[model samples]
Target: MTSNTEVFPVLETKRLVLREITKKDANSILDYLSDAEVMKYYGLDPFNSLDNALDEIAWYQSIYSNKTGIRWGITLKEQGVVIGSCGFHNTVSQHSRTEIGFELSKGQWGKGIAAEAVEAIINYGFKHMHLQRIEALIEPPNLSSQRLVEKIGFVREGLLRNYEFTRGKFDDLYMYSLLKQDLDKINSM
Candidate 1:
Protein backbone atom coordinates (compact mmCIF):
# COMPACT_ATOMS: atom_id res chain seq x y z
CA MET A 1 0.00 0.00 0.00
CA THR A 2 1.07 3.56 -0.68
CA SER A 3 0.30 6.70 1.29
CA ASN A 4 0.37 9.95 -0.63
CA THR A 5 -0.61 12.86 1.51
CA GLU A 6 -0.25 15.51 -1.15
CA VAL A 7 -3.25 14.85 -3.31
CA PHE A 8 -6.83 14.72 -2.14
CA PRO A 9 -8.33 11.49 -3.38
CA VAL A 10 -11.34 11.76 -5.59
CA LEU A 11 -13.63 8.77 -5.88
CA GLU A 12 -16.21 7.97 -8.49
CA THR A 13 -19.15 5.63 -8.74
CA LYS A 14 -21.75 4.82 -11.40
CA ARG A 15 -23.66 8.03 -10.74
CA LEU A 16 -21.68 10.12 -8.26
CA VAL A 17 -18.36 11.86 -7.82
CA LEU A 18 -16.81 12.06 -4.40
CA ARG A 19 -14.46 15.03 -4.26
CA GLU A 20 -13.00 17.62 -1.95
CA ILE A 21 -15.54 20.22 -0.87
CA THR A 22 -14.72 23.88 -1.34
CA LYS A 23 -16.21 26.95 0.29
CA LYS A 24 -18.33 27.33 -2.82
CA ASP A 25 -20.27 24.26 -1.82
CA ALA A 26 -21.24 25.60 1.59
CA ASN A 27 -24.71 26.62 0.52
CA SER A 28 -25.37 23.16 -0.81
CA ILE A 29 -24.12 21.65 2.39
CA LEU A 30 -26.35 24.02 4.32
CA ASP A 31 -29.42 22.96 2.42
CA TYR A 32 -29.42 19.40 3.73
CA LEU A 33 -27.65 19.91 7.04
CA SER A 34 -30.17 22.53 8.04
CA ASP A 35 -33.07 20.18 7.57
CA ALA A 36 -34.28 18.89 10.92
CA GLU A 37 -35.32 15.64 9.34
CA VAL A 38 -31.79 15.09 8.03
CA MET A 39 -30.24 16.03 11.35
CA LYS A 40 -32.73 14.07 13.48
CA TYR A 41 -30.52 11.07 14.13
CA TYR A 42 -27.23 12.75 13.23
CA GLY A 43 -26.44 13.64 16.83
CA LEU A 44 -26.18 17.35 16.11
CA ASP A 45 -28.77 20.06 15.68
CA PRO A 46 -29.45 21.33 12.22
CA PHE A 47 -27.05 23.95 10.92
CA ASN A 48 -28.50 27.45 11.32
CA SER A 49 -26.39 29.47 8.92
CA LEU A 50 -23.83 29.46 6.13
CA ASP A 51 -21.10 29.87 8.73
CA ASN A 52 -22.11 26.55 10.20
CA ALA A 53 -21.57 24.95 6.83
CA LEU A 54 -18.27 26.76 6.41
CA ASP A 55 -17.20 25.51 9.80
CA GLU A 56 -18.06 21.99 8.75
CA ILE A 57 -16.01 22.29 5.59
CA ALA A 58 -13.14 23.60 7.66
CA TRP A 59 -13.33 20.56 9.92
CA TYR A 60 -13.07 18.36 6.90
CA GLN A 61 -9.94 20.21 5.81
CA SER A 62 -8.46 20.11 9.28
CA ILE A 63 -8.88 16.36 9.48
CA TYR A 64 -7.26 15.79 6.14
CA SER A 65 -4.39 18.08 6.99
CA ASN A 66 -3.84 16.40 10.34
CA LYS A 67 -3.84 12.97 8.68
CA THR A 68 -6.59 11.93 11.06
CA GLY A 69 -9.46 11.56 8.56
CA ILE A 70 -10.91 12.42 5.19
CA ARG A 71 -14.34 13.44 3.94
CA TRP A 72 -15.68 13.70 0.42
CA GLY A 73 -18.50 15.80 -0.89
CA ILE A 74 -21.04 13.68 -2.69
CA THR A 75 -22.15 15.09 -6.03
CA LEU A 76 -24.09 13.74 -8.93
CA LYS A 77 -22.08 13.28 -12.09
CA GLU A 78 -24.54 15.26 -14.10
CA GLN A 79 -25.15 18.11 -11.66
CA GLY A 80 -21.76 18.69 -10.00
CA VAL A 81 -23.43 20.04 -6.88
CA VAL A 82 -22.90 18.61 -3.42
CA ILE A 83 -26.01 16.88 -2.13
CA GLY A 84 -24.27 15.51 0.93
CA SER A 85 -21.00 14.26 2.34
CA CYS A 86 -19.45 10.96 3.51
CA GLY A 87 -16.17 9.65 4.88
CA PHE A 88 -14.16 8.34 7.77
CA HIS A 89 -13.14 10.02 11.02
CA ASN A 90 -11.51 9.13 14.36
CA THR A 91 -8.84 7.35 12.37
CA VAL A 92 -6.15 5.57 14.34
CA SER A 93 -3.26 4.49 12.18
CA GLN A 94 -1.67 2.54 15.03
CA HIS A 95 -4.84 0.53 15.42
CA SER A 96 -5.51 0.23 11.70
CA ARG A 97 -9.06 1.45 12.21
CA THR A 98 -11.43 4.34 11.50
CA GLU A 99 -15.05 5.34 11.98
CA ILE A 100 -17.34 6.12 9.04
CA GLY A 101 -20.03 8.78 8.89
CA PHE A 102 -22.35 9.95 6.16
CA GLU A 103 -25.49 11.94 5.39
CA LEU A 104 -27.53 12.68 2.28
CA SER A 105 -30.14 15.18 1.19
CA LYS A 106 -33.71 14.03 1.65
CA GLY A 107 -34.17 13.86 -2.09
CA GLN A 108 -31.24 11.52 -2.46
CA TRP A 109 -32.31 9.05 0.17
CA GLY A 110 -33.63 5.63 -0.98
CA LYS A 111 -31.79 5.98 -4.27
CA GLY A 112 -28.90 3.65 -3.31
CA ILE A 113 -26.52 6.60 -3.75
CA ALA A 114 -25.31 6.31 -0.18
CA ALA A 115 -24.56 2.63 -0.61
CA GLU A 116 -22.60 3.12 -3.79
CA ALA A 117 -20.57 6.05 -2.41
CA VAL A 118 -19.93 4.30 0.90
CA GLU A 119 -18.81 1.09 -0.76
CA ALA A 120 -16.25 3.02 -2.79
CA ILE A 121 -14.74 4.60 0.32
CA ILE A 122 -14.75 1.36 2.28
CA ASN A 123 -12.68 -0.23 -0.45
CA TYR A 124 -10.36 2.75 -0.36
CA GLY A 125 -9.96 2.44 3.39
CA PHE A 126 -8.88 -1.17 3.13
CA LYS A 127 -6.73 -1.04 0.02
CA HIS A 128 -5.22 2.43 0.34
CA MET A 129 -5.50 3.55 3.95
CA HIS A 130 -4.34 0.10 5.09
CA LEU A 131 -7.18 -0.19 7.51
CA GLN A 132 -8.09 -3.49 9.12
CA ARG A 133 -11.44 -2.34 10.44
CA ILE A 134 -14.00 0.35 9.57
CA GLU A 135 -16.71 1.21 12.07
CA ALA A 136 -20.08 2.89 11.93
CA LEU A 137 -21.86 4.29 14.97
CA ILE A 138 -25.58 4.44 14.43
CA GLU A 139 -28.28 5.84 16.68
CA PRO A 140 -30.89 3.16 17.41
CA PRO A 141 -33.55 5.27 15.77
CA ASN A 142 -31.65 5.57 12.50
CA LEU A 143 -32.90 2.43 10.83
CA SER A 144 -31.92 3.53 7.34
CA SER A 145 -28.28 4.10 8.30
CA GLN A 146 -28.17 0.77 10.10
CA ARG A 147 -29.44 -0.99 7.04
CA LEU A 148 -27.00 0.85 4.80
CA VAL A 149 -23.98 -0.32 6.77
CA GLU A 150 -25.27 -3.87 7.10
CA LYS A 151 -25.86 -4.05 3.38
CA ILE A 152 -22.21 -3.07 2.86
CA GLY A 153 -21.02 -5.97 5.06
CA PHE A 154 -20.66 -4.28 8.46
CA VAL A 155 -21.85 -6.48 11.30
CA ARG A 156 -23.65 -5.09 14.31
CA GLU A 157 -21.31 -5.53 17.22
CA GLY A 158 -23.56 -4.34 20.07
CA LEU A 159 -25.48 -1.48 21.54
CA LEU A 160 -23.69 1.03 23.72
CA ARG A 161 -26.31 2.47 25.98
CA ASN A 162 -26.03 6.19 26.48
CA TYR A 163 -22.56 6.12 25.00
CA GLU A 164 -22.61 9.62 23.62
CA PHE A 165 -23.99 12.99 24.55
CA THR A 166 -25.69 14.64 21.66
CA ARG A 167 -28.62 16.89 20.91
CA GLY A 168 -28.86 17.80 24.59
CA LYS A 169 -29.06 14.21 25.82
CA PHE A 170 -27.20 10.95 26.15
CA ASP A 171 -27.99 8.68 23.24
CA ASP A 172 -27.69 4.96 22.61
CA LEU A 173 -25.67 3.89 19.64
CA TYR A 174 -25.17 0.61 17.84
CA MET A 175 -21.60 -0.15 16.89
CA TYR A 176 -21.06 -1.83 13.55
CA SER A 177 -17.84 -2.86 11.87
CA LEU A 178 -16.41 -4.32 8.69
CA LEU A 179 -13.02 -5.92 8.89
CA LYS A 180 -10.63 -6.25 5.99
CA GLN A 181 -10.94 -10.01 6.22
CA ASP A 182 -14.69 -9.58 6.10
CA LEU A 183 -14.43 -7.58 2.90
CA ASP A 184 -12.14 -10.21 1.50
CA LYS A 185 -14.79 -12.76 2.23
CA ILE A 186 -17.38 -10.57 0.56
CA ASN A 187 -15.29 -10.07 -2.56
CA SER A 188 -14.59 -13.73 -2.97
CA MET A 189 -18.24 -14.59 -2.85
Candidate 2:
Protein backbone atom coordinates (compact mmCIF):
# COMPACT_ATOMS: atom_id res chain seq x y z
CA MET A 1 0.00 0.00 0.00
CA THR A 2 1.32 3.42 -0.89
CA SER A 3 -0.66 4.92 1.92
CA ASN A 4 1.63 5.39 4.88
CA THR A 5 -0.98 5.24 7.64
CA GLU A 6 -1.81 1.61 6.94
CA VAL A 7 1.82 0.44 7.30
CA PHE A 8 3.42 2.76 9.80
CA PRO A 9 4.27 -0.16 12.06
CA VAL A 10 5.90 -3.05 10.19
CA LEU A 11 6.88 -6.65 10.82
CA GLU A 12 9.94 -7.34 12.89
CA THR A 13 12.44 -10.19 12.87
CA LYS A 14 13.99 -12.12 15.73
CA ARG A 15 16.86 -9.70 16.31
CA LEU A 16 15.28 -6.45 15.24
CA VAL A 17 12.39 -4.19 16.19
CA LEU A 18 11.02 -2.60 13.05
CA ARG A 19 8.93 0.31 14.14
CA GLU A 20 7.76 3.58 12.64
CA ILE A 21 10.15 6.39 13.30
CA THR A 22 9.02 9.19 15.60
CA LYS A 23 10.20 12.62 16.61
CA LYS A 24 11.02 11.28 20.05
CA ASP A 25 13.78 9.24 18.46
CA ALA A 26 16.10 12.20 18.16
CA ASN A 27 18.68 10.36 20.21
CA SER A 28 18.36 7.18 18.18
CA ILE A 29 18.90 9.07 14.95
CA LEU A 30 21.86 10.71 16.56
CA ASP A 31 23.37 7.33 17.35
CA TYR A 32 23.69 6.25 13.74
CA LEU A 33 24.36 9.79 12.52
CA SER A 34 27.74 9.85 14.23
CA ASP A 35 29.25 7.05 12.20
CA ALA A 36 30.71 8.08 8.86
CA GLU A 37 30.97 4.49 7.77
CA VAL A 38 27.25 3.96 8.21
CA MET A 39 26.47 7.38 6.80
CA LYS A 40 28.56 6.63 3.74
CA TYR A 41 25.66 4.91 2.01
CA TYR A 42 23.00 7.20 3.48
CA GLY A 43 23.70 9.74 0.70
CA LEU A 44 24.49 12.34 3.27
CA ASP A 45 27.24 13.03 5.78
CA PRO A 46 26.86 12.47 9.50
CA PHE A 47 24.57 14.81 11.38
CA ASN A 48 26.34 17.89 12.63
CA SER A 49 23.98 18.44 15.57
CA LEU A 50 21.04 16.96 17.41
CA ASP A 51 18.70 19.46 15.79
CA ASN A 52 19.56 18.05 12.41
CA ALA A 53 18.67 14.59 13.66
CA LEU A 54 15.42 15.90 15.08
CA ASP A 55 14.47 17.40 11.75
CA GLU A 56 15.30 14.17 9.98
CA ILE A 57 13.28 11.99 12.33
CA ALA A 58 10.36 14.39 11.97
CA TRP A 59 10.50 14.19 8.20
CA TYR A 60 10.59 10.41 8.21
CA GLN A 61 7.72 10.25 10.67
CA SER A 62 5.59 12.56 8.58
CA ILE A 63 6.02 10.58 5.39
CA TYR A 64 5.68 7.19 7.05
CA SER A 65 2.71 8.19 9.14
CA ASN A 66 0.94 9.27 5.98
CA LYS A 67 1.53 5.84 4.35
CA THR A 68 3.44 7.36 1.44
CA GLY A 69 6.27 4.91 2.15
CA ILE A 70 7.44 2.33 4.65
CA ARG A 71 10.46 3.13 6.82
CA TRP A 72 11.57 1.33 9.97
CA GLY A 73 13.87 2.18 12.76
CA ILE A 74 15.94 -0.96 13.30
CA THR A 75 16.50 -1.69 16.97
CA LEU A 76 18.60 -4.57 18.14
CA LYS A 77 17.04 -6.90 20.69
CA GLU A 78 20.24 -7.46 22.63
CA GLN A 79 21.12 -3.83 23.24
CA GLY A 80 17.69 -2.30 22.58
CA VAL A 81 19.32 0.25 20.34
CA VAL A 82 18.34 1.75 17.01
CA ILE A 83 21.47 0.86 15.12
CA GLY A 84 20.07 1.16 11.63
CA SER A 85 17.04 1.67 9.40
CA CYS A 86 15.39 -0.15 6.46
CA GLY A 87 12.29 0.14 4.31
CA PHE A 88 10.60 -0.16 0.92
CA HIS A 89 10.38 2.84 -1.36
CA ASN A 90 7.81 2.68 -4.16
CA THR A 91 9.24 3.71 -7.50
CA VAL A 92 8.95 3.55 -11.31
CA SER A 93 5.17 3.57 -11.56
CA GLN A 94 5.13 1.84 -14.92
CA HIS A 95 7.12 -1.15 -13.58
CA SER A 96 5.02 -1.56 -10.42
CA ARG A 97 8.13 -2.30 -8.32
CA THR A 98 9.56 -0.92 -5.14
CA GLU A 99 13.16 -0.27 -4.07
CA ILE A 100 14.53 -1.61 -0.81
CA GLY A 101 17.03 0.29 1.31
CA PHE A 102 18.99 -0.37 4.49
CA GLU A 103 21.78 1.11 6.58
CA LEU A 104 23.33 -0.23 9.77
CA SER A 105 26.02 1.01 12.10
CA LYS A 106 29.50 -0.39 11.68
CA GLY A 107 29.19 -2.45 14.87
CA GLN A 108 26.37 -4.50 13.40
CA TRP A 109 28.23 -5.50 10.27
CA GLY A 110 29.14 -9.11 9.26
CA LYS A 111 26.30 -10.67 11.23
CA GLY A 112 23.93 -11.36 8.32
CA ILE A 113 21.58 -8.74 9.72
CA ALA A 114 21.13 -6.91 6.42
CA ALA A 115 20.13 -10.06 4.60
CA GLU A 116 17.85 -11.07 7.42
CA ALA A 117 16.10 -7.74 7.36
CA VAL A 118 15.80 -7.81 3.59
CA GLU A 119 14.25 -11.25 3.71
CA ALA A 120 11.63 -10.09 6.16
CA ILE A 121 10.75 -7.03 4.13
CA ILE A 122 10.67 -8.99 0.89
CA ASN A 123 8.17 -11.41 2.34
CA TYR A 124 6.07 -8.54 3.58
CA GLY A 125 6.13 -6.87 0.18
CA PHE A 126 4.80 -9.92 -1.61
CA LYS A 127 2.44 -11.17 1.06
CA HIS A 128 1.04 -8.14 2.82
CA MET A 129 1.86 -5.28 0.49
CA HIS A 130 0.83 -7.27 -2.60
CA LEU A 131 3.78 -6.14 -4.64
CA GLN A 132 4.65 -7.93 -7.86
CA ARG A 133 8.40 -7.46 -7.72
CA ILE A 134 11.06 -6.07 -5.44
CA GLU A 135 14.18 -4.23 -6.55
CA ALA A 136 17.44 -3.07 -5.06
CA LEU A 137 19.41 -0.26 -6.71
CA ILE A 138 22.86 -0.61 -5.24
CA GLU A 139 25.73 1.62 -6.21
CA PRO A 140 28.35 -0.23 -8.23
CA PRO A 141 31.09 0.24 -5.69
CA ASN A 142 29.30 -1.18 -2.65
CA LEU A 143 30.47 -4.81 -2.61
CA SER A 144 28.88 -5.71 0.71
CA SER A 145 25.39 -4.57 -0.27
CA GLN A 146 25.71 -6.24 -3.65
CA ARG A 147 26.48 -9.57 -1.99
CA LEU A 148 23.75 -9.12 0.55
CA VAL A 149 21.12 -8.63 -2.17
CA GLU A 150 22.32 -11.73 -3.99
CA LYS A 151 22.19 -13.75 -0.78
CA ILE A 152 18.46 -13.12 -0.50
CA GLY A 153 17.89 -14.46 -4.03
CA PHE A 154 17.80 -11.18 -5.97
CA VAL A 155 19.45 -11.55 -9.37
CA ARG A 156 21.51 -9.03 -11.24
CA GLU A 157 19.07 -7.53 -13.72
CA GLY A 158 21.67 -5.19 -15.28
CA LEU A 159 23.50 -1.98 -14.74
CA LEU A 160 21.35 1.13 -14.86
CA ARG A 161 23.28 3.76 -16.76
CA ASN A 162 23.64 7.01 -14.84
CA TYR A 163 20.71 6.01 -12.69
CA GLU A 164 21.69 7.77 -9.51
CA PHE A 165 23.52 10.85 -8.33
CA THR A 166 25.84 10.39 -5.36
CA ARG A 167 28.54 12.67 -3.99
CA GLY A 168 27.53 15.19 -6.68
CA LYS A 169 27.97 12.92 -9.74
CA PHE A 170 25.79 10.54 -11.72
CA ASP A 171 26.75 6.88 -11.29
CA ASP A 172 25.79 3.51 -12.70
CA LEU A 173 23.77 1.18 -10.52
CA TYR A 174 23.74 -2.61 -10.27
CA MET A 175 20.12 -3.69 -10.36
CA TYR A 176 18.94 -6.73 -8.41
CA SER A 177 15.46 -8.14 -8.45
CA LEU A 178 13.22 -10.86 -6.97
CA LEU A 179 9.93 -11.54 -8.63
CA LYS A 180 6.77 -12.43 -6.69
CA GLN A 181 6.24 -15.61 -8.68
CA ASP A 182 9.72 -16.83 -7.87
CA LEU A 183 9.39 -15.88 -4.22
CA ASP A 184 6.18 -17.87 -4.03
CA LYS A 185 7.90 -20.85 -5.55
CA ILE A 186 10.71 -20.68 -3.02
CA ASN A 187 8.29 -20.35 -0.12
CA SER A 188 6.12 -23.24 -1.20
CA MET A 189 8.95 -25.68 -1.66
Which pairs of residues collide in model 1? none
TM per candidate comes to 0.95, 0.85
TM-score of 2: 0.85
Global fold similarity of model 1 (TM-score) = 0.95
> Candidate 1 lDDT, tens digit per residue, 5-92?
5888899988999999889999999999999999998877899999999999988988888788999999999899999899999999
Model 2 steric clash pairs: 3-67, 4-66, 4-67, 4-68, 5-67
Whole-model alpha-carbon lDDT for candidate 2? 0.75
**Overall lDDT per candidate, in order of appearance:** 0.90, 0.75
Which residue segments of model 1 deviate by more than 4 Å? 1-5, 185-189
Deviation from native of the Cα of residue 49 in model 1, angstroms: 0.6
lDDT of 2 at 188: 46
Instruction: Please write out the lDDT profile of model 2 over residues 58-157, one tens digit for every residue.
Output: 7666555554457777877766667777887764445667888888878889997777777777787788777778888888889999988776778899
